[model samples]
Target chain A: MTGDVIASRDNPRIKRLRRLAHEGGAYRREGQVWVEGDHLCAAALAQGHRPEAVIVTPAGMHWVERWRREGGLAADVPVWTVTDAVMGHISPLESPPSVACLLPLAEGTSVRPDVPTVVLDRLQDPGNVGSILRSAAAFGFAQVIALRATAALWSPKVLRAGMGAHFGLHLVEGADAAAVEALRVPLIATSSHQGAWLHTARLPWPCAWLFGHEGQGVDLRWMARATTTVRIIQPGGQESLNVAAAAAICLHASAVSAFGGL
Target chain B: MTGDVIASRDNPRIKRLRRLAHEGGAYRREGQVWVEGDHLCAAALAQGHRPEAVIVTPAGMHWVERWRREGGLAADVPVWTVTDAVMGHISPLESPPSVACLLPLAEGTSVRPDVPTVVLDRLQDPGNVGSILRSAAAFGFAQVIALRATAALWSPKVLRAGMGAHFGLHLVEGADAAAVEALRVPLIATSSHQGAWLHTARLPWPCAWLFGHEGQGVDLRWMARATTTVRIIQPGGQESLNVAAAAAICLHASAVSAFGGL
Candidate 1:
């Protein structure tokens, strides 16, 4: 059934939605995050995370009503129609989508690391996290371990950056360095300072590709245990690469070395 | 000289800074954008784009005052010391920086035809734009051209993602297909559907690398004019790559092929 359309900015539910959409810790505090646009909404639904409520702009009301008629949103679930201005006020993106839904955090499943893995160390940027996830999915990394201090994997910004790839992967956040050390495969670290040139280096198959913090790079402690540290030879003048770019190249090389058979 | 610490949110200058930070067009309308944190502020000074005014948090004021005494900010520039909460109101990043400065737009420059270049077609995300800029800078690409639909290169989000590479590269935006054709160089196109595998393909040196839309890819019209079309062999499960990831690969491949001294 439809809840009354909310036009007022001060509506408690609307305010809560705004907080969940804009602020950082809302996901942890509320145990929910806003999923926007039709594709991401569909992705969440397909994954069986039912919407607590569906919010739509005036132009989007026809579809929302049709969804109700088709028994798409649960009978008990509420649908709130908001004005475009209010929608923009709550959107994390530049252009607010016509529809944004409230979806519960999908519980983290046991990470069964069957294929090659990626270990992120203190990677700070959400965009980097998202890009890494997309690359990891593309290259068929079995799991992504987000070490403590790395950006939250499920944050709205990261979700948008990942472009629905998050739904398909096994991602663990706040993973300790020791936990990464415990993985079954060899940990191949990437650094600019010391390592064999990646192109000529013989990369091991089915190894864990270790990528470190954006500024600091891989911690020295982990470097001590690295099975091998590889470097992308830079002939150009720039000193180093953006960490996410490095991750993509390293992971792709790993995929290539494995004959991309996994 | 320092101004009365701006205590009210409705102060005209504060409102203007907030607008510039959040709204993209504010830069064009007001001829300025809010550049936050020490690095960007330092970069602006280095590039000779002096700040019109600065607002610093109490903690920020200490270092900023020292910088001002050391001739960091322009002599005539006004400094407004404020609380961290006030700075947070105008910051685009998750955490508010210690200082925020409003800087005017840099003068425009044309893309020189005879240089290794990168062309972005309809790449909509800002972070991707920033990453591509970083890649372009790293791989010795002389210029970066963004199609009209691509995210603005100097937009705060893009600048932040670029980590100051924007200032280092010649960036041109609002480009058209015809304009891209105007550049008299061998255009190398990247595609997943049809092309020689990039690794084995003979790529021309000092060429322009053209990467197309994320979903649709380089337009057919552009592809027809491509001197060579190269594809990355993805032996894994994915159908295609993230455009930025593909761009990095193609650009790096081009660099290697061009300059590897075969």
Candidate 2:
């Protein structure tokens, strides 16, 4: 089906797109997220999702055209081709991408207690949180429990940083202490100081790793509750690594210890 | 000594600071970089660096006052108090930080051929470059060689993401292929595909790890020159990991292999 040409910025769909693109939390209210670029949109389709609607600029029409030719999109899904002005008005990026799709936010769900998990405790930076989610998925951590005050899991910045990893993992946002406590797996906390060295530690498999705020570490309560804590030895005497870097190292170590060298 | 209060943003020193804050390569032109926040300032001092001058807003005066009282900063290093308006005008941050220091950029230096090093092959993002620097320091990599197209090492964004890692590492920027090949140690390239698994590789000590662009893998010329190529095992079957995350994982693996668990 041919996409409808939307020339005016005042179009209702364009206004809605603007909100979802600029306001990170607008998705929560509208129950839909705007996924831009082909990599993300394709990832969504690979996961068997049908976009509620598609928005394309002239630059993005080629991808939509190809997908339609390939019968990759359903006939019922609306595709709107907007003018550059309309796209620029709706886009948060300086150089707005050519195409984007609106995907419904998955319904709220409880944490899966048995899988390998990473708990984000009040991580404020969307980039850091999204990178952690990407690392978590790569290293076999299946779930992410983001505590209250953490950057919203589905925010545009987070989604962009995640690079489509969001489509692959189970994420629980705005989780409280009780939700974390309910996990059956051991809670392992990572600290830059005061723990058994990561490579030397006897890491448990199928555990949940708790990484805390960018500056402050895991909450003291979580630290006290942890079954074990691991420290990544900083041989150069730097005080700490970036939180996402720390998570990648720690998660990789756990994956190696449990499943042997990748 | 009491600080001179500069109330106007048009002051010459304030103008210089605004340039450094807003332009990533302004440091190269000005021969100095602006270090912001108490954490970064303290990190510099801890490394025995004395700022050429200090700029403080009212919000930042208390620390400067405490430092002067404690005899931490030198008598000759001028501290200028600026109005909040002046600070806001110079600062790129939404809520401008209370204080920043001007440090002279060190003269260009060549890489130490035999030390563990990281070769950034045109990675574009300042955050990625800075995060890799932080990881390099944490994992015992003593030197970082950023290729010609990579983000500048002393850029404000990189400095912020580095979180003081720049002070501890030997950084050589704008390097070419000749500079990279001059290193005496092995060139170890990391790829998401077509390499020995990282965990099982016989990781050589004091090797130079090549991490490439965010969108592309290492330039094929460099890839073919690598003594050994290693890939991180991604059990989740994800196509690729973020460049910085990959760097942290690869560098940490090398550190662990070279030095027994810390």
Candidate 3:
């Protein structure tokens, strides 16, 4: 399934790839997400996903061959070789990776009602959204629901920040309060003030933790749905914690309670 | 101490302030740091630090007067009123803040020997550095030491990311491993692999935790100095945790242990 080498940066496939890399919402329109670097590609493959197409530099051709031999890539996957200049044109990073792939967005999955979950309410930073996803996956939160105003879950920057956590979890983006309300588990909202101290509180093991926007916290509509609200105590008295840091602390607390001492 | 309104962007003071906003190391050369927003300015004043000068938009003049009335700003501090155009020229944010101030970089402080501390080993992201500082301060890590290779501690981005955490902690930047070695308490290194599980370990109350670069773990040189190494158990099996997320978990664990259930 090898294609003719795309020498021109303006090739249709190359232009689409560039759009996918640069536009946060392109995946929603194109039906595929672009992922760069070997680690992400390998992670997708390890999760039983086959790339629709792979773009590689001439120098990366050997690495792709190694992947096929090692069972990290499929032989039938379309492979396109490109010049350094073309690769640069499609890259979103300052230092471009050696290879990249287009993975079809997994069809939207319904949120499982009883499993541990994380609900992101209008989180704007790609880094924060991705970091929360990573923590959710690491701490046994099997599903992530991102509200409509949140940064696009499949954006390249979020993918890089997630560091391969995307493939392992059920990620539902453009979700609304109704989707969150449908969950059977207790909804826990994190606040910097106006709740029980996190450490002393008995966090529900299989619960949905709601983290909100950088400045305005959980939306008032969603806050009305939360069964419990907890605040990470700031003993030193800074106004608030970074949302990603707060998510990590809250998720780890639940993990600790469930696993019983690490 | 009010200066005549400076209407030109080419003014030397305005040019220097713009450089301080854009350049990471400009504070080191300019002998001052730039802070925007009411929260950070109020935090600095609460810490008993005086501003050398306060720059405000015409609309912000009334706010500055209120600050003076409330004693958040000294009556004698130089105040420069700039038009909206000049304010935009000096601002790094897309939405320019109404006001900003110049605070002298306090002379570098030495890491206190026996207090809870955080040693940053070449961590490059300003957001990560600032978030870590917020966590350290919240969890009772009274001091932070950044290795020479780390991001500039007083840089505008770091200052913004810190969210007023900078004023609350003793920060030492451009420090060498020698500075870390002088700490009398046991040094702890956090790794994704190879050590006791962080939750189960009896963490030292006043220990120093070494966090490293985004891609690189702590440098091998400092690993030799670690009295204990701990790993946060990842139940879902992601390869590693984000540095700031890891720091929050580790610091919170130590805080819980020391403070006896916050």
Interface RMSD of each: 2.3, 1.3, 1.5
Each prediction's number of clashing residue pairs: 1, 0, 0
Q: In candidate 2 chain B, where is summed lDDT lowest over 10 consecutive residues?
A: B1-10
In terms of TM-score, the best-performing candidate is 3
What's the TM-score of each model vs. the native? 0.75, 0.96, 0.97
Return whichever of 1 and 2 wins on TM-score. 2
lDDT of 3 by residue, A1-262 (tens): 4566788987899999999999999999999999998888888888888999888988788779988998978888989999888999999788888898999998867777889999999999898888888888888889999888999999999999999999988988888767887899999997766788888888887999999999998899999899999877676665578899999999988988887553
What is residue A134's positional error in candidate 3, in angstroms?
Answer: 1.0
Q: Residue B118 of candidate 3: its Cα lDDT?
A: 94
Cα displacement (angstroms), candidate 2, residue B81, comes to 2.0
Q: Which regions in candidate 2 have their CA more than 4 angstroms from the true location?
A: A1-3, A68-72, B1-3, B65-72
- Interface RMSD (one decimal) of model 3: 1.5
- Model 1, position B108: C-alpha lDDT score: 67
lDDT at residue B144 of model 2 (Cα atoms): 96
Q: Put down candidate 2 lDDT per residue, B83-138, tens digits, no spaces.
A: 88998899898988899899988886887889999999999988889899999988
lDDT of 2 by residue, A85-149 (tens): 88888889898888899998888769898999999999988888888998888888899999998
What is the C-alpha local distance difference test score of candidate 3? 0.88
